[model samples]
Target: MKSVLQQLPESVLAQILENAFQWFVVVDKNSRILYINEDYCQFLEVPRDQAIGKPVDEVIENTKMHEVIKSGMAHQASPHYIKGTYMLANRVPLIVDGEIVGAFGSVVFRDMNDWKKLSSHVRTTMDKINMTSHEAPNKLYRLEDIKGSSKAIRSIKETIQMIAPSDLSVLIEGESGTGKELFAQSIHERSERAEFPFVKINCAAIPEDLLELEIFGANIEPEKHHRKGRFELADNGTLFLDEIGAMPLTIQAKLLRAIQEGEIEPIGSNMTKQVNVRILAATNRPLEHLIEQGKFREDLYYRIQAITLRIPPLRERMEDFTELANTFLQQYILKAGKRRLVLSSRTREYLQNYHWPGNVRELQNVIQAAVYLAEHEIIEPTALPEQLKQVRKKPVTQFVNLQDAIEDLEKMMIQHALQDEKDKRIIAKQLGLSRSTLYEKIKKYNL
Candidate 1:
């Protein structure tokens, strides 16, 4: 049997190898080519009969494959040797017993013609195998879980819940960190098409040149193939466009076309595929301002504003500060694995008066910081960040008694004079007051 196998014709052996793979090649210990399948010949741009007895180095001279044989080890590279290519390969030495032998390998080619196809194939495969890719479509957060409980916030949540089942495009207006996207998610989860995808696209995140391709997708570069945009991904579902005010005028036109027609056409393709998507757009700025400035499209604004929802600033909803603070404290305590903490009466009082420039988002961040920094289970004023400390300090004085007020004013005035004049004697002269009076106020006020 060994003699018969050794005496087998090259054509018969090549036929067996071809049945096992698309391509195959074999070499002796001398690194001379002993066999080449039809696929291998075509891949190397050589004739099978002519390549059979030739050295692999001569067959594909100056190539990385030759280096593999020379070093007697497996070698792999990418976008290598061949121009305009991207390749992944596995090469392994075939050793028998204790004797050294030759090797075999395989390559998956990635060129301009096949890169898109390969990438798409990989994405589809991964999506099929990964539970995360297909589950619970849009991201989730709740209205009750939202930080505020003031009349404005209660009314807003009630409106959000009421409109949750509707298919109308929701326009969420709020400043940064007001959680417009959270509102968008709440709507989608409650909607009739909750099982479908909830695709999000940040209109302000992408460059104008690429935003078109990102939103409507493209096919001009065949290497990238034709991709489906957010609208397509959210078919029978919802699409959230953040910072909608920053979207370019030209792209706005395309968006309007898709909304009106209920379909999108890829950049390089003329065919339009119907998409069922309800758009929820959010922006901190006024769309009317953008329209007046000629920065946003008027028709598109009307299309997206079918049902507008405005979120009031934290300063405007100051009545909810304590509730928001307590809720945040509970969350932080649980997350930090600490004992339940009650806010100090002073802290709660000061919190209610804060302007909260970053709104609910800022409040959450502040409470979280305080929880981690607190020495005791109770959150004290000192545990807050330096910025919050400054905010709370100024506000706490507002609630002080008349004596404290007069004393604080006296201290402030003297500090200002000293800062301005750079000397206590000069400050007394500048304020038209005696040095003894200045010294007395300083001592009494603890300046």
Candidate 2:
């Protein structure tokens, strides 16, 4: 037996689909909208032509047609909100010759009243959650976003999962470029306090005198512009204090009192208010050294350091470079609207060998730069930053024994550049030698 779609011409088939689906859309394999019904267009307050060829995300308020097409799986009775109304939707792959060619989506509701009842129920739950505006930060990164399999990163994730449920104050210690704050936020997201607001402030960024006012709420004597302090805003939630080592001694005493007593006195107010906030602190500085120097209070240090987690820098976790590079490549490629891109073997070696002082953050930036700068699908060493190309040329120390010194210098430079700038041609050019001569010297020197 032939199906209606199989028997009818494409022009008649499209008209039949438009009439049957009232609120419907069809997308290509790439998740680009190919067709939208007049009913959906009327609800969208736009013309049918306007919605076509745009990505599904831009076309629909909350649609999963793209995911359905990508995974070749049908999603039925999925909750999707449109124009502030709750709706149930079905998205199925449009298969051709047993191959997924695109996706078809339609709204599923008994009537308008059915949608209203469901929407009201969901809204009640949302009101109870009361998610704050600051809760969802930039790029919406979480634990899964770490994208590394190195032992150091694995341990960090494990430790965070273990400690997140507790109400203890966590002190995150790491170098400037390491993702200390990312781990802290992941902890907050996994904890029981997930429903509450998550606020963040950098201690180093605020002035010493203004830091106190920032912690405790302040009322500016101006023409009607007011602000809430961190404690008040973060009540019953998590407050992330970044660069905690730079906090003033006076502010530290107040912060310690607040942590111990569960209360805070807002600036310009005589009364103190109670606030129940989980504190997550981060620092790149040495608190112990500050304590010894009489710059930091021991009591406050102990209060905040109930638990300490140290993040390993990228240089220490080159084993994770491959995954990290690919993760960044895919991310940038999607954003750039380009096809899949890959790093050459030599480029990968360069990434693995370079000392990333700025850690994961630096690698992400370098890759983002490479995605746009690299001319071909395969990223070559020529596509990397000039600093990476000219690395290891500056000697760390002076050497004696001219012939031995030259050999040692060559070996040191090669090793230094082995991970991040591995093209032999580039290496030869940097060292002022031919490719064959460079290989001969590497063999002679056993480097």
Candidate 3:
């Protein structure tokens, strides 16, 4: 380039720059506007003469042009909010003969609708980034949102249906991300107390000092704004205690008494308020093991375990992964405003077979991240999270004993024979065994 500005006349240069931007403003070192285009003045609804003499910030809401002038540096390609709208702007120092005299600024898409259309895609990408990178949500799940076709899941649903109506203390045990809260809500909704509130508190999330105050209402001074605890708020309804195993042994005694007496005595209070609350407690920790270690109270365990349910980890229920994964993928795809992104069959199979140590939550998170990274509408296995992509299916285990090994081998051979040749005699002949022997073996192995 041969110094295009030098070759051009001042009036010609002004006309070209005016046409290039939706809005333009030039400010001197004092941040006093030296020049502003007619469009910018019209957008601000101020006359060009008035805008030129004033500071850019005084004229525009949320202006950062003053920053560029102060720092003598460029603030390029950054989002600048003006009048409750996001705009792409670049503010660069105007250096004349190696001396910083002023700054030049230009904006694109002054129309709010145009900015919204452009920024929507950016927002979608930002949401994806947040979903993948941030911590797990305190997600509330409904009974219908629960995904699984496995017998285990069916049984879990049936159990909730059976037990939810009852007024008993239910203890839920599972690995983290097994959706303990999901099950708890299902039970609550199915219960007679569904019309009332459902209050949940993670005993581990609150500090030990504040945990007592949170669970049992405090009777401290200035009682006007003093509020009820989880127990009082959940009166005549369901109270879900997450990570109940994390409660200190000292607090366990008080909790046990509350359950046993059907009332809670707040700290620093002699009076006990009667509460008809059904307790649903959950924990990833082994309560029995904790009791044995004397870290948890045995009496507390008995009180909470009046009705116990254990959710099997995701790896154990591989049959459900495909459905669960797609459910998550669909939710996130709609959230990101992307298409109905499809997962390749190979990707689905790989996901189903992989060991999900973090369970359904991990699967959902990985899918969200994948949806963000996917180039096309179809998400390949390569788009999966780094942890999931590195997962290798474990080799099938060998039989423990010679008798078991021989039995499995015989069973496999018999199944293959039956699959290929339907007739009993033909199957026997193919296996080099007599029909009677084959029948006896089939009956013995229950195959």
Identify the candidate with maximal TM-score. Answer: 2
Tens-digit lDDT track of model 3 for 305-412: 888898999977665665576567756764565645788867766786678889988888888888888889889988876665565875464645576557657765
Pitting candidate 1 against candidate 3, the one with the higher lDDT is 3
List runs of model 2 lying over 4 Å from the truth: 1-90, 93-139, 222-226, 391-447
Candidate number achieving the greatest lDDT relative to the actual structure: 3
Q: What TM-score do all the candidates reach, one by one? A: 0.56, 0.61, 0.58
RMSD of each candidate? Answer: 27.9, 15.7, 22.0
How would the candidate models be sorted by TM-score, starting from the highest?
2, 3, 1
With candidate 3 superimposed using the best TM-score fit, by how many Å does residue 288's alpha carbon deviate from the native?
A: 0.6
TM-score of model 2 vs. true structure: 0.61
Q: Which ten residues in a row have the lowest lDDT in candidate 3?
A: 108-117
lDDT score for residue 149 of model 2: 55
**Residue 73 Cα positional deviation in candidate 1, in Å, after optimal superposition:** 58
Q: Regarding lDDT, does 1 or 2 come out ahead?
A: 2
**On a 0 to 100 scale, what is the lDDT of residue 64 in model 3?**
83
lDDT of 2 by residue, 1-447 (tens): 477558888888767887896588889999999988876764554445557888888867667887898799898766665543345678899999999999999987624334445666555543433454245345334686565655567788888888999999999999987888888889888888888888899999988888887888765666533467898888888999999999988888889999999998777666778899999999999899999999889999998989999888777665566657766776676456455577887887677667887888888899988988889888898879876765443223354557645655566576455445646678888878897887676554323
Give, for candidate 1, the lowest lDDT window spanning 10 residues. Answer: 77-86
